[model samples]
Target: MSSAAPQAPDAAPDQDVRRIDDRSPWWGRLRAAVGRSRADLAVVLLFLAAAGWLTHGLWPDPGSRTMALNPADQVLYEWFLAVDARALLGDFGLLTDRLNAPDGVNLMANTTVIALGVLLAPVTLTLGAPVTFALLAGANLAGTAVAWYLLFTRPLGARRLAAGLGAALCGFGPGMVSQTNSHLHMTAQWLVPVIVWLVVRMLRAADPGRGGPDRLRLLSSAVGLAAAVSAQVFVGEEVLFLTFVTLLVMAVTYAVVDRDLARRALPAFTGGMVVAAGLALLVVGWPLWFQFLGPQGVATGLFSPHYFSADLRSWWTLSPLSVVGGDDAARLTTGPAEYNTFLGWPLLLVTVGCALWLGRRPLVVACLVSALAMGALSLGPRLVVDGQHTGVPGPFALLADVPVVDGALPMRFALVVLPLAATLVVLAVDRASASTGRARRLVPAVVGAALLPLFPAPLPTSGRPPVPEFITGGYWRQCVPPGGVLVPVPPATPRDPWPMRWATATDVAFGMPEGFFIGPHGRNGAATIGTSKQPTSALLAEVATWGLRPAVGEEQRRQAERDADFWDASCVALTVDTPYADSLRGTLEDLYGPSTRIADAWIWRV
Candidate 1:
C-alpha cells in the first residue's frame, strides 16, 4: 500500500498544456487572405477611383457658376466661417454673440449640420470651405465603410464576403448615394444602420451572463446610443424616427426576453440618453427648451395627424429614377417608389420573408415588433383606415398630438423604422443562409443583386448640362456682405415652410449683419444664445409682432437706418415675401442714395 498509490503523474497544468493552435490551416488562411477584407478593400478602392474620376471630370472650373453655393449650404457655411474666424481671433464674446443671435438660433436647430460645421470649423479655418467639405465628405464615406464592417463582423460571424457585400450595399445604397453631396447631416443619417448594429452589440454584451465590467459596457452602449441620438437630433425629425425605432427595439427586446433585464437596462439606457440629451442641450439645448417652455412654444402648435401625412407618391417619382425632380409646387399621390427607393422594395420583401421565416428567435421577434411599430407609423393614416392599426394601436392618435412629435414633420417618422427593417432583412437572410449550403451561397448573391440597382449610375459626361445657379436675394444677400446689420423684419407667416419661414428673416437681420447664421428659425439660434437674457432690441421689436407686414414698417426702417449707421452696414439684403423688403429698400435708397445689386437680393454700396 506504499503511501498513496503513487498518485498518477500529476496531470499537466492547464497553463503548461499547450492548447491546440486554433489558427486556420494554410488553405483556410489562403482563402481568408483572398477574401473579405481584401475584397472589400478592392471594392472600396474601385468606388473611390470612380469618384475621383468623376470629381476630376466634373470638378468646378475656377469662376464657374455651377459650383455656386446652395442657399441652405451657403447660409451654414458662412455662419461657421464667421464663428471660426471670430474664435480664431480670440473674440469669444463676438463669436458667442453672433452664434446666439436670433438668426443663429434658427440654424442651430439643425443640430446635424451644425455639428458638422463645428467639426469642420478647424478644417475650414485652416483649409477653407472647399477643402473642409471635401474632408468631411470623405470622412462620411469612411464612416459608412466602417459601419458596414462592424455590421458584418459579429452577428454575421465575421463572414468576410457577406461583410464586404454589406459594406458595398451601404456605399452604393440609394440613401447614401443620393446624399453624397449634401454634407454631414444626411451622410450621418445614412449611417443609422451601423449605429443600430453597434447598439445591438453593446446590448448583447450587456447581458448579465456575459458579464465583464457591465457598467463599462453600459457606459459604452450609452455613448453609442447617445451619439446616434445626437446625430439624429442634429439632422432633422427624419432621424428622430430612426432613433425612436432603435430605442423601441432595445426596449421591447429586453421587455419580452427578460423583463428583469429590461428593467435593469432602462436606467442604463436612460443614463445613456441623458448623456446624449445633455450633450445636445450644451450644443443647442437652451433655445429648444425655451421653445417648448416660452410664449412662442405654445403658439407653435404641436401634434396634428395632418402634420405627419405627405404625398407618398413623391417618394418614388421624385428620385433620380423618376423623371420628376423636386417640384415643390407639384402634388402627387403615394406610390411604392416614393418610400422604397432602389433597394427599398427588395429590402422590404426580404424583411417580410425573414420575419415570417424566423418568427421564433427572440432577437428576430424583437426586431419584427420594432419594425412593425415603426412601419405602422410610416403608413400614417393608411394603417388606421385599413384596420391594420389594431396591431400597434395606441393613442398613436394621442401620441401623434404630443407636442414634440406633433411639432415636427411627422411623415419623417419613417426614418425611425428603416434600420429595424434593414436588420430584419439582414437577419432573415442570415438565418436562411445558415440553414443550408445552397442557401448560404445563394442568399448573399440575391441580396447583392437586389441592392445593385440602388448603386449610383454612370452619367454621360458630354451632355451633363450645367445646373443653373440661383441668384441670392433678400435677407441672405444683405447680411452675408461685409458691414451688414440685422434689419428687424416681421415674424414669418405659418405658410412659409422651413428656412423660408423663420430662418430667412433671422439670417438676413441677425446672421447676415453679424456674419453668422443658424437656420431658418430662431429655434436653434436661441439655444446657442443660452441663458443670456440680454435682449436684441432690433430682433425683439420686430418679432414681438407675428405677421410680416408690421415688422417691415417705419419702426423697422428707422431701426435699420440706425443699425446701418451704427454697424456701418453699407448695403441691405432682404428676404423676399417680407413686407419690409420694399420699405427697407426705399428707406435705404432715400437715406443713403443708390446701391448696387450683387445678386438677386443683395444690395451693395454704390
Candidate 2:
C-alpha cells in the first residue's frame, strides 16, 4: 500500500471561473437575471403572445371597436374605469351621482373591479378608458396563465412543457375565451393560484413525515392568504366566492379519499384558516359589509338561476368561440359571455380517462370528485338538454336560495371545473413526459388532439356608435358646469347607453339621470339594471322605443321642467344621426324650445 494519501483530484478544468459582478452595468445585471429565469420568461412571453392574438381586434381601434356580443358590459366597465380614475383625483366614494344622477349609484353593490381599476388608473386617465379596457382584457388571460404555470411547475413538480400546456388551458380554454367578450370580472383569475398554493402549503406542513407543521411558516402563509383574499374581494367578489366554494369542495373530497392524510393535515389547516380568517376580516370585512348591507345594496339575486344555468349538452358541445370546432350552438348558453361549459367531447373524454387512470392518487381523486360536484351544480335547479327541459331537478336546487350562493350564476361553477381539468392534464402530461418510448409520444399526441379543437379564436368585435364631436371636442364643458348634469335628449338608460360613453369620454365631467348599472329598484332593495323611472325619463324611453312623437302639452312641459330641475340639468344634447332623432328633437323642442345645432349633435342649455 502507498504510504502517502492520494492527492486531491485537480479541480475540473471545465468548471466555471467567471463571477457575476455586483457592480456591473444595469443592463448586464438584468441580462444575468433574465438568464436565470429563462423558463419563466418564455412561459410568460408565450401567454402574452396568445393573449395578444386573442385581443388583436381591439388594439386596432380600441375607442371604436367594441365587443359585439356584450357591448353594454364593455361600456359599463369603461365607465367604471373612468370613474375609478376620477376617484383617484379626490372624487373618492363608494357611491356616486355620476350615473343614475339625483338618486346616485351604489358602486359597492355592483361588479366593480376597484382594485384592477385603481391599478390601471394611469392608463385610464391618460390613454382613455377604452385603451385601459383593452389592455386589461389581454392581461387577465396572460397573467392567469403565468400564475397557474408557476403553481404547477414549482409546487406540483410538473415539467415546463406539461405545466405550460395545462396553464394555457386554464387561461385560454373555450370558457375563458368566451368570458373575454367584456366579462372582465370573470376573467381576472390571476390571484386564484396564489390562494390555492397557500392552501397546499398549509396542508403539506401538517404532515409529520414532512417535519410536522412549522409554526412560523404557517403564520406567515396565513397572513399571505389573508392578504390575497382581501385583494381578491376588491377585484371580483363573485369569483372569490366561487373560489371559496371550490376549496371547500376540494377539502371535503380530499378528506373522503384519504382519511389518514386529511386527519394529519387537519391541525395545520384549521390553525391556518383561523388566522387567515381573522386577518382577512381586518382587511376586507368593511367592504364586504357595505357590499351586502350598505346604502342601495341589493338584498336579492340579480340573475335568474334557471336562465343562466349550463345546458347538459354544453359539456360535450364546442363553443362558438372555438377556432377549429365552432358551431352555431348558441342555444346551449345564455350569451357569448356565459359560454361556461363548452368543453368539447374529446377533452371531456380525455379528462375522464386521466382521472380514472390516476384514481389512486389522493389529489387526483379530490380534483375529480370536486369537478363532478361543481359540474352537477352548474346544471341549475332543473336539467336541460338540446334546448329542451328535462324536468329533472338538479343538485343546485338544494342550494338555490342560499344567501351569498344565490347571487352567483350557476354556469360560473364550470369556471372551477376548468382549473381542475387542467390539473388532471398536468398530472397526465408529467407522467407521460417521464415515461419512455411509446407512452411519451402517444400521450402528448392524444393531449394535443384533445386540446387542438378548443383553441380560442380572437374575440369578435364591431364598431360602436361614434361619440359625437359635440361631446369629444370639449363643447360640452361650455354647456355643463362643474359637477352638474348633462341630460341626453332621450336620456341614457340600459338600452341607449351611448350617452354614458360621452360622460366617460369627458372623464365624468357631468352626471346623467339614468345609466347602465345595477342598483335598488323597489322595496327590500331588489336588484335591477337602472334606477326607477322619473316621469320625463319614462316618457323619453317610450318615444325612443316606439319612435313616435307624442303630443306635447303644458302638462308635459311642466313635467320635463320638474325632471330637469331634479337632475340639476345644465345641458341636453342629442346625437343627430341616432335612430328616432327626429322624434326626440321634436319632443325636446316642444318642451324646451328650439335647439342649437353644433358639431354632430343638437344642444340645449338647460
RMSD of each: 10.8, 7.1
Clashing pairs in 2: none
Tens digits of per-residue lDDT, candidate 2, 1-606, equal 000111112111111112346677778767766764885798899999999999998977799999888898898899988887886788878888888878888878877788998888888888899999999899999999999998877667677777888999999998888899898988999999999988777676655546777777788888999999999988988888888988898888777766777677678769888999999999888777776678777777888898888999999998888887556788788888988899989999999887776555767777888899999999999999989989899999999879877767999999889999998888787777766768677776888899998998888888887788988898887788868998986777787677789888888878988788898785666888887778988888888889999999999999989988998888888888878999989988998899988888888887
In model 1, state the lDDT of residue 19.
31
Looking at candidate 1, the ten consecutive residues that score lowest on lDDT are 1-10
Identify the candidate with maximal lDDT.
Answer: 2
Best by TM-score: 2
Candidate 2: where are CA atoms >4 Å away?
1-36
Off by over 4 Å in 1: 1-40, 46-58, 61-107, 134-142, 155-158, 168-172, 175-184, 190-198, 211-213, 219-241, 257-318, 321-344, 381-396, 428-436, 458-591, 594-606
- Per-model lDDT: 0.43, 0.83
TM per model?
0.63, 0.93
